[model samples]
Target: MSQPSQRPEFPVHLLSSPAMIEACRERDFARIFTLARRAGMHNSLIARLCDMTASRVGEVISGTRQLRDMAVIERVSDGLRIPGHMLGLARRDWESASADPTAPTVDIAPAASGLVPTLPGADLDSILAVAAGPKLSPSTVRALHSSIEDYWRRDDEHGGEVLRPAVVGQLRYVVDLIKETGEGEYRRNLYGVAAELARLTGWTYFDARQYSQARTYFTEALHLAKAVDDRPFMANVLACMSLQATYEERPADAVALSTAAQDCARRQGATPRVMSMLSMREAFAHASMSNRSAAHSALAEAHTCFERISDQDPDPAWVSYFDETKLIVDTGIARGRLGEAEAAEPLVEEALRREPRGNHRGRAFHSFWLARIQLQRGNLDQACDTAASSLELASVVESERVSGHLREFHQQLAPFRKEPAAVAFETQLRATLR
Candidate 1:
């Protein structure tokens, strides 16, 4: 329904006409009805809206009848959605119900079942179309979520470069499922599922070191998570973005992002494991900035969070990879970033021994750190051997990020290129690059 301020179909322009305004000011229904009829509203509809007979409205339009009753006038004001001052009456009840244009509108819509996911400033037809899709069964939704965990498992053993297409394909299909799940409890659940998949898509790109593409997906994941009010997942995406920033040598951005992630995790009562992971990110950010004391404090906080972990905690599937071994290795990575390889090397070595052989990609990643630490400790021969072994472990993986670490380690070998160990490692590195 158009407002009184609008045009011909709504008749606001007619009210603005000098002749019509004069008729309204004098309470002349005969002339007012004549103006209304000329603007396309018929006598029959006007009669029904104004609670009068068709003959009565026709007589008024024909200047043969007059309206003097206040109740009839009020009905005319309301039925046409007119503001009351235009009709020489007090403001009506419906006019008072209009939304304030100055108020900020969030994109979120309240769920009759669960929140209806919407893009910002979405048009009416698209929102209405949300209710038009197929109603999915519980089993189908379960399978879609299950596929997400399966992708994570595969992404652990193999690098994400080869698996990115499949992961993105799954993400698109989940979004399609979200669209199909119109007015059910499954709608919110599907958005939650899509949120995690979007986060994983970002993770795959992050592993490939495609930072811009990675951030785009990370933002999408955050938007999806926010749509369902999934605070834990929102924190997860922020943490991943923080890690990417750390890689890009943007410590201030990394610190800001990780701090935000920590805030979300703690506020949401996320499990101890989640808190631990977020703390680790903060430590990494601090280490990158060479804030050694703050880095150690964050690491201590991470250890405390780890100590609080309980079997009863409702940890999400995404945090399943952040076990004690991973925590230890992450601590080493953070320590090494602050030039503490003497302290970092043992923790990484222990994690390597404890971690499973099936986690070749993770082990390969940690192995590069081990080689870097060995070089920092001036054990060039051991560094060369460790670097070569890391390459062999990662041979089946396609991670650019892991290769990035190897390259960084290789640069430190420039001063030692004439050494037999360096010559041998260079030969091995060439074969691996090939």
Candidate 2:
């Protein structure tokens, strides 16, 4: 019989740090090697873990080498126990798809409510038990979280058009589990997971431009999160609502929602990344209101929060996507909202240059903002090129939100309809989107 393959494990703290996240997103071998070395992994161990020679590992750490081959990257991911999606790869074999009772506990604050949660008896339990599988065990809850992460990856790459049903269905099942499971951590965590699924469901609806439905689901998510007192996720749901408010031209509501989110985040011990993310939403709200000083002040605070991030701060998986590149792009988007094209363009461009290869939806969204800034600056040719690039990226990602941005750009092009650059882009947009 073949021996079990050796799988080295790195500390979760090492894998989830912001620097490690950015390095993995950019596929910066040098930075990855350096981070591992700093985390106390010796050169030879790093070599053994990454399936590279000690010399190669040293060269990478010293910035004398780079890893570009996909096969080599996969080896590094498996060896270092890096989650595949961080590298833009598919979920690895190590990421189990099935739920077993022995899986690690799903992390959530235990419910303090003395009363346990249980359904008010219905025959539906017998009917759904087969599909629901074993009564919501720790392993099952962990699997649900893992599936949520996969759904996030899918939305990141391809948007949420098709994932909505699966998300909503799972949410229904989890809601049922909450009703059946009598109290304790299992039921509490189930509420939390249900909240996560509901939030993702709202996000999909928002992505598809179904604003009314999105609002309904977001509200549901907030209520569920409140049930378990999951403050961070509650704040996250509020931030989502705040962003949606900005889209709906409700700057006052946006500001209120973002402020509420920031307050919630501050009430409890939250990671710098979480605070930084909430601060950006506050900045966005201010930018929408054209409050330049306030927006910039918020942006500066966000940067300060980001700078305070350290290895000891264990950020939740949901906030992992808000890495340095995301912060820069979000900052640029806020500037764009404030009509500061001169300041926004370069920041967005730099972020795009560092963005990961597989984040098609994010690239599309960021490119749309960059295109808008260029148009605002009267750089017609550059704007058209940027918008065209955005269109190409959005073409692969199923997002009406992106399409809406492109449409907004096209509407702004009306005065320049006869301009060759504008004409070319308009033609391409119509041809591609149609």
Candidate 3:
């Protein structure tokens, strides 16, 4: 692909209104066709853009082809004039149906479940209709990007539920925009964001014990990272995949993925922060595989990496959380897993103190790790107390990994089966398990 043009600047914040959506949805096909012609897109080029045969495009426009293929439907949506977001929704619905025809299809309800104003359903439809029909305007592209960034920043926590259908809807819209615009740099930036969202989705599904769904999301994320040629981001995907594997008790597989991630980071000259994060992941895999020596070695490397980080380009998105305090917490978890209660507790406690205020998620995870240490030290009461607090935080985040950590804690408490607290915690944890 040629270098992308300096994109026309538009105020991102103004794009969230319903009016634009409605305008795009009501876009005219003749106008869209004219726009395409003006852009010098021949029938063959349009066919390629839609991933269809040239004859098929002609047949669809001429009302000969039924456009049974949802892919083609999206292409037509693209060929006509639909807003990118609406086209995305339509395509997602179509794809989901194709995957499982029996699955229930939900209507497009684009409420601003995020920080941005929600576009009306009609407006959203019109915008997508126009985007699909004609070449998109620079303004529309900027709007989609803004909406996605808003979605990225949204935080909806409801007693363990993150009702984020609206955010997902916007992300799909951004994905469609990326595909249609063929803007490599923009697409690359978006892919990183997409991978994080996909990982978050996978983690949520994993918490629900929907292993199949979680794995699917993770796999798709890996594909997206590859598309953007983001090796470190891909490593993050692999590391998260290893976490899933570890939870599934597939220690060997987890170890392999962890190793692969570490190697990829090294080969790519990943930042110290990124490499440290990967090293911590490797340590977890080693602990899972019962290789205490390897786990300790990985932990040491992670610490060394933390010390070596220097001025460089920004860290990869996924590894942003791997600071000194977090690394210490992770190392403590690794030690606890290796049955070093005495060694792990102090480190964990110190790490806990360093955890930044207001990070409820991190605090919850730290509590879980503390619970693990308590359990290993044979302090069932303390462990149960910590577990309860962890559960309270886990309840807010909709994270499967958090739930899995709690599940492991619950399993450890089983030896105290006759104890009331142990029984109660186990029951509560099991109820949430898939």
**Across residues 43-154, which tens digit of lDDT does each residue of candidate 1 receive?**
8877777778889888877777655434466667666555555664433445432332322232333334343333222111122133455557889678777888788778
Model 2 C-alpha lDDT per residue in residues 1-434, reported as the tens digit of each score: 99997555666777767898899989897888778778778889988877789998988888887665455777887788776657754344464423212222222223345232321111122222355365656789899999999999999899986776567667767775676687688978988888888889889877876565577678878888888888998999999999999988899999999999989978878899999999999999999999999999999999999999998898988899899998999999999999989989999999999998799999999999999999999999999999999999999998878988898899899999999999999999989876
Compose the digit string of candidate 3's lDDT tens values, residues 165-229: 54444445545445545555654666666665566555544544445545766776776677667
TM-scores of the candidates in the order shown: 0.69, 0.70, 0.63
**Regions of model 3 farther than 4 Å from truth:** 1-102, 106-164, 419-434
How does model 3 score by TM-score?
0.63
Q: After superposition, how far is residue 382 of candidate 3 from its true place, in Å?
A: 1.9
The all-Cα superposition gives candidate 2 an RMSD in Å to the true structure of 20.7
Number of the candidate with higher TM-score, 2 or 3: 2
- Which rank order by TM-score, best down to worst? 2, 1, 3
Give per-residue lDDT, candidate 2, residue 375: 91
Clashing pairs in 1: none
